[model samples]
Target: MISRFSNVNRAYVNTVGISSVFNIGDSMQITPSIKVLAIQREQEIYYDEEGKFSQFPIFEEEIPQPVFYEQLTTNFFNKNPKINVDSISVTSISSSAILQIGSTKDIVCESRTKHIRQSKN
Candidate 1:
């Protein structure tokens, strides 16, 4: 197997990310798991000559359960036995991503994001 990478000036990997990989790489196994919950609340109040009123309610939500990595990995390998790649070339990889040059037994990446926005006036 031969891998040649050229003219790679700059690469940025953020949060849960993978960088660059050079030649003659073998058996690259990477497992990245991430869970994110983002909540935003906005409230606006208006006042007149008579009076002013503003009301905002509380927000409540339950978080989801985590993923089973062992089962996922087993299922992946069982489904795909022979995943062969002679050569690979890439410019960049970011945000729970993978950059593989050669052979690998297993590669599993999982990400879950939940966003909630509440506005009151």
Candidate 2:
């Protein structure tokens, strides 16, 4: 396979992320699994405020079950074969993205994110 890249300004990959893939000459197989639990708290205060801010509490029962178990037991990819690519050209690949130019047998990617946000004003 022939891959040509002209310019790549920036790439931001986070957590379980794949930024870019220029080229895969031969066959490629990838299996990636990720589970993330993120909690964020925000509080806004004014200049004329007087009293103190209350505490933020997180109870044990508020949490939920994990996300990896159910996904692990499932097979979501196709069982059919794929044709190979002859040539490819990419100008930019940014921000948790993927660019592949080749043949792939089985590619399974699983990502679960549980985000909890609390804001007080």
Candidate 3:
């Protein structure tokens, strides 16, 4: 299957990979996982109290002690009379950073839901 792990951008580092696939009835369950490692060249953007923004240097190879992990799961079904996305589940994992200088952790931000319709009447 085509996945994020296979088509990662060259500008950032990631450890996401597919862990397993299990067939249950007519639906298939997919498990996509991630492990934390520092993002290369991805800046930590910050906004101060006075409404000024600043860029902080995240040193090279500094593994992120991420405070939040977000995942988006999409269910797609074709326009057949009997098929539709029934449900989805997402999970994330993380570990403690050993060489980072700040107590501050990373925020993985995203909006979590979307919907599309395919119907035959």
lDDT of 2 by residue, 18-37 (tens): 33344343345655544444
lDDT minimum window of 10 residues, candidate 1 = 50-59
Q: Which is the winner by lDDT between candidate 1 and candidate 2?
A: 1
Model 3 scores a C-alpha lDDT of 0.28
Q: In lDDT terms, how accurate is model 2?
A: 0.44
* TM per candidate: 0.39, 0.38, 0.16
> Whose lDDT is higher: candidate 1's or candidate 3's?
1
For every model shown, the clashing-pair count is 0, 0, 0
Sorted by lDDT (best first), the order is 1, 2, 3
Better of 1 and 3 by TM-score: 1
Best by lDDT: 1
Query: Which stretches of model 2 miss by more than 4 angstroms?
Result: 1-23, 43-97
